[model samples]
Target chain A: MKAVVTVTGTDRKGIIAQVSAFLSEKNINILDISQTIMRDRFAMIMVVDASECTEDLASLASSAAEMGKDIGMSVRVQHEDIFQAMHRV
Target chain B: MFNSTEVIETIDMIEKEHLDIRTVTMGISLLPCVRESAEQTAQAVYERVVRSAERLVPTVGQLSREYGIPIVNKRVSVTPVSLVTAAFPEQSPLVARALDRAADALGIDFLGGYSALVHKATADYEQKFLATIPEALAVTQKLCASVNVGSSRSGINMDAVRQMGGIVKQTAESTQGGMGCARLVAFCNAVEDNPFMAGAFHGVGEADRVINVGVSGPGVVQHALSFAPEADLTEAAEIIKRTAFKITRAGQLVAKEAARRLGVPFGVVDLSLAPTPARGDSVAHILEELGLEVVGGHGTTAALAMLNDAVKKGGVMASSRVGGLSGAFIPVSEDIGMIEAAERGAVTIDKLEAMTCVCSVGLDMIALPGDTPASTISAILADEAAIGMVNNKTTAVRVIPAPGKKVGDTVDFGGLLGRAPVMPVHCGSAEKFISRGGILPAPIHSFKN
Candidate 1:
């Protein structure tokens, strides 16, 4: 299963490093990563393979959201299918 | 991987535009649950729903979290209770209570199908069952009742239509502030697999259980049209079609996955631009975005017709199964724009009636004067039913005659039921028209053979 993880907030040091470390702890392999700035806010999108993660995607998504709150950012983890389904067809 | 702009657009629709799945309804057949007596049947009905939908709420919760979208409602529809309680039609309220209990137990939002189909003619048992609707709606918190009074093939049953008027009156008077009427709808050409509430029922022809999803994105469409303000009417419609395609694709994904996870057959994705009372999420606002000063202004019907057609055309390609009343709903109370329009005299019942000729449902969530006669209500239903019967579309009425309330006064039901200002009805009486009780014959066009 693949999921899209998004992080957006004021640009700061180590945003990618923090998110990547968290995904590594959960055994979710990052398949792709991209970062950019929009309207002076740092934004990152990561496509990750969640087949090896022990926790269910729902719980893992919530944990990621909680991690974001602690670091003063907005985070969301959604199945990649939702994006593909809406944007592709 | 999706481009950043596409991903951001999707997220913006969800976060800023209030785009969400309106409902993920499970249709369960209660025919197998009917037992010897009404008591036993009620017990069986309760147990059947509980057993069939035990995992529904949690599964929807997980799906909402995993997909990063809000699934606003989890509902269930079953074989119309009148059919299930046919043997003991007089005691149908027992089944109604049982269904409400089952809804409470399963923690679902609403349970529809406390209904009777008298489109062509009302049988003796069905007639008796229809009498239970008023008390059934009053006593139960989450039970929805619908009476299909007319159909394209069967025409209109004036007898049942007259009875429904009295029933709606009684339901309004019995429930607080006429709120119960919000959960009861009078339908013409009611579909078997509607995922929307106050009109959904699991048809006897359907599989034992199925998952149906209703997707709503009025705000998304409005946002899409915002960027195309300079576009012509053709360009505006193209924008709506493209937006509807995207919205229906998301719905198709949710419907398939929800059905797969719950081990139920996947039913249609009702691509209705159902609105909410929230400011940014009104279907009327979408029409206004298309250049109407207000939703009830001139050219409203044309705008709605184009919108309805474009939505269906786009949604049909995105999902193989698309059914229900899949068009823009113009419920006055549930939509902030419509509510404002009604309050300001920008819309009236007559205008709404004209609009229903092209849109999805008819005269929905409208509040009338407490003194408005039952005959008038029946007449309203008859007029709307005629539109559905002749046009071969679905039409419904969910008007509330708020007790002791008059025009300019609003009745607040709160939450998704929203608030409705008491709109004035015409002074003329329809008693003579409604009292002559018989069947309105099927339309000439219905004879397709």
Candidate 2:
């Protein structure tokens, strides 16, 4: 299963490192990553392959959300189909 | 990799603008459920629905979680109970209860098809079934009923319309604050695959089982328009079209997936901008964004015509399976903006009727004065049905006469039914006109052959 993890908040150091490390721990592989910071707002989109992850997508999403909360950011993990379905055909 | 902006836009629509799958309705045919006795029929009906719809609620929940969009309602629309109970129309309430119990057992809200189609003429059995509607609605919590009284091909069934007025009143009187009337509707040109209640029934022509999805995003359209406040009407309509396209695509995806997982044939996506009582999620608010000071203002119908057309135009492209009432809904009580407009006396039933000509449905969720005559309700239905019959469109009336409540009083149904302010009706009686019962003859335009 492929999912997109989006993180948005005030920019800070180690944001990518922390998120990537969290994914690695869960056996989820990052297929692509994009990040940009405009003024004080920060945004990053990570496309991850979670087919090998032991935890289910719902549980991983909640855990990622919890991690985001602790770091003072808003994070969401959603299936890629929703984005493709909306933006594509 | 996906565009971050597009991702953020979709998220904003869901998290902020209240875009949602209004309903994922499984249409189950109850034709085969009828048995030798009413009790046997009721039992069979319950079992069939429970088995067919067992996975409906949980499947919808999983999809909602996976898609990250809210699926607001999981509903079932069965074959009209009138046909299922035709053997013993007098005991139709038994079937209604069984349907209600099926809804309860399936953990779904509002199972529709407690209906009678007397658009041309009311049969003796149908009349008996019609008499049971008020009692059926009063006895069941999750059951919704609809009656078809007019069509372009058959004109208006004034007799059925007359009966519906009294039926609406009785339903109101039977339930607290006339809330049961909220679950009943009188229709002209009623569709078979509509997923919205209280007018949804699996038409006899439909497949044995199908999935029809109703998609809602008035808030998304309003939000899109907010970005183009200075745009002209044409440009504003473009914005609505683009937003509706995106919303419907998501709905189509959900509909296809929900159908595939549940092992039902994918039906259609009802591209309706149905409103809820929540602030920022209103079709009336979208009208106000188009420069009307309020929804019922002078240019409201023109704006709604463009909106309704643009929604259908865009939605039709998004899904080939677009059906149901594919336009904007203006239910008074269910829209916070419309509710406020009515509270301030700016929106009236007269203006609502005019708006319905261009929109999807008619006279929805309106609260009339407690003493409003049943004949007057019949007249309201007659006028709305006439509009629909002439224009070859679907129109419905779902008004509640709040018992012991007059103008300015409010009836709070809570949840999606919302709060309705009792609006005054015309004092001039239509008793004589309604009492003269006969068919109103098909419109000349209906003879297209």
Q: Each predicted model: what fraction of the native A–B Cα contacts (within 8 Å) does it retain?
A: 0.85, 0.57
- List, residue by residue over B22-88, the lDDT tens digit for candidate 1: 9999999999988999999999999999999999999999999999999999999999988988899
Instruction: List the candidate 1 regions with Cα displacement exceeding 4 Å.
Output: none
In the order shown, the chain A TM-scores of the predictions are 0.95, 0.92
**Interface RMSD for each of the candidates:** 0.7, 1.2
Instruction: Please give each candidate's TM-score.
Output: 0.99, 0.98
Clashing pairs in 1: none
Clashing pairs in 2: none
For residue B334, give model 1's deviation from the true position in Å. 0.6
lDDT of each: 0.93, 0.93
Q: What global local distance difference test value does model 2 have?
A: 0.93
DockQ, model 2, C-alpha based: 0.68
Instruction: Enumerate the chain B TM-scores of all models.
Output: 0.99, 0.99
